[model samples]
Target: MAIQRRGFIAAVGTGGAVGLAGCTGLGDDTGDSDNTGPEISGETLTLTTTTSTYDTGLLDELNAPFEDRYGVTVVTVAQGTGAALETARNGDSDVVMVHARSLEDEFMEDGFGVNRRDLMFNDFVIVGNSDDPAGVGGEEDIEAALTAIADAESEFVSRGDNSGTHTKELELWDAAGLTIEEFGEWYIDGGGGMGEILNQASMQEAYTLADRGTYLDMQDEIDLEIHVEGPVKDGPDELMNTYGIVAVNPAVHEHVNYDLAMAYIGYITSVEGQDIIESYTSAGEQLFFAEALSEDPEFQQYVPEGWGSSTDDE
Candidate 1:
């Protein structure tokens, strides 16, 4: 059973809040309202999203209701944020939902997508062996923690998949005035998804940056500890991870399903969809927060009550 969506916000304090499966051209498959009666079944919408959501099974939970409601099958192609965007750029997917903000911007400017919408958010956490070899445990300053890890030449694992987590890891290294190359053998690139890298890090006892949701979901099977994460309310500001969705531009890729893709964008950003995100949990812990419903300029247009500032009336 799911929790009540409104109460989820007050109860969890999630920093605030906030598919498609088709391969056809716009309106070629998932039909419009006019043809809704007889042709509503078995339409496909291909969704390309990130490891953070995919690894934790949030994608399945989130899409199940949406897929059943529309009678549309959603084929999820999961990878690091960079790869997911690349899949959309090549016009292989109908829509994208990923974390890396700068890459999302580049994707839009390069004419890959439109109707980009802020979806949801969950911060990253630094996980490591409980031994505290790097002495980074409980470090309030993420930069300092990273610097300490480098200075000690402690074993550190990187997703190295150009993922949003990897992107954030690189940014943290930059902020720490260090580089992975300089760390030499102490730093290892796992070149895999969150769960794989986390498992590798656990076996090797290395430090790594992981989305909190994924870490929590996989924690039972691993021995790693949350070495450097604070409570959501007090977590490092720089660690905040925001996820967004975009409808692949039909103009750039003429064979894309623009209409159904937009419906997906609309569905996930709507109150019901955001609520679905808020209500989802495992072991009684909510995996994500609904930032789309917040009063931010980027998301205001999508908020139902006209409560926030709308940048494009969305």
Candidate 2:
């Protein structure tokens, strides 16, 4: 299915402060409304964030403890970064947690958002079968690895769903001077979310790029090994994969819960929030690394003095 940009905006209007009592299915109703319960007079907030964080089970760890401490409930709508950003732009969501730095900057520059803050980060990796048919294993350079994959005509599954992850992958391929047209047959655009793309890659025994967090979370279900990592895995100047949070500008859309949204952003960037992100792990492996907001020079260029730390590890 094509990513639903409009549905994301509409979904934000449906949020409430109630904690989901069960494993609410991805598309299930969230039980939120204007007068369904107590007015959002307290600290409860709604967040529209990326599917990568949600799929990897990081948000739950961050939100559960936060709700108890702040007497607030965080209702999250997990979608592509573009969708999440659109939701914020439309004032359907209070805050947005997303990875596409360039897009996030545009959102802020366009006045759809404010108080854009840097949060935690993780890297993306190229995974493949143990046999390494594409011979990309252990390659320290991403461009070279991708070139080898294209030259070898190995199966490469792509999440063509226009997600932040997908956007990053396309950027890397473009940077390699290898257009999608040049590697047509070998590339399989899964056109889905991260988890589904990983599943397809495992089934095909193909090479695919994935965020470290999602791959670690679903590692048990796949046989692929991390063939490329570190700078090659999205931490060089070009591959830096940063995640940020922004509160939608109340001026753009009146329905946004501005105070609650800012609170969510503030809490996520706070020492306690960073601590929660640092402590999140899957299968004994750390999913994300916290970058001190106070220490980053690039963060200073985009954010105010006390917004929060931004992570560009990926």
Total clashing residue pairs per candidate?
Answer: 14, 6
lDDT of each: 0.78, 0.73
Candidate 2: tens digits of C-alpha lDDT, residues 1-314: 11111111111121233232121221213554433432333455778888889998889888876676556788989988888888777777888888887678778878898777667677788888899997877676789999999988999999887678988999999989998976677799888888888899999999898888888899999998998884423434454556888788888887777766765665565556666677788889988866533442354535544335455342
Off by over 4 Å in 2: 1-44, 232-238, 295-314
Best by TM-score: 1
In the order shown, the candidates' Cα RMSDs to the true structure are: 7.1, 10.9
Using lDDT, give the best candidate's number: 1
TM-score for all predictions? 0.83, 0.79
Cα lDDT over the full model 1: 0.78
Q: For residues 138-176, could you state the per-residue lDDT of candidate 1 as single tens digits?
A: 888999999888889889999999889999899999988
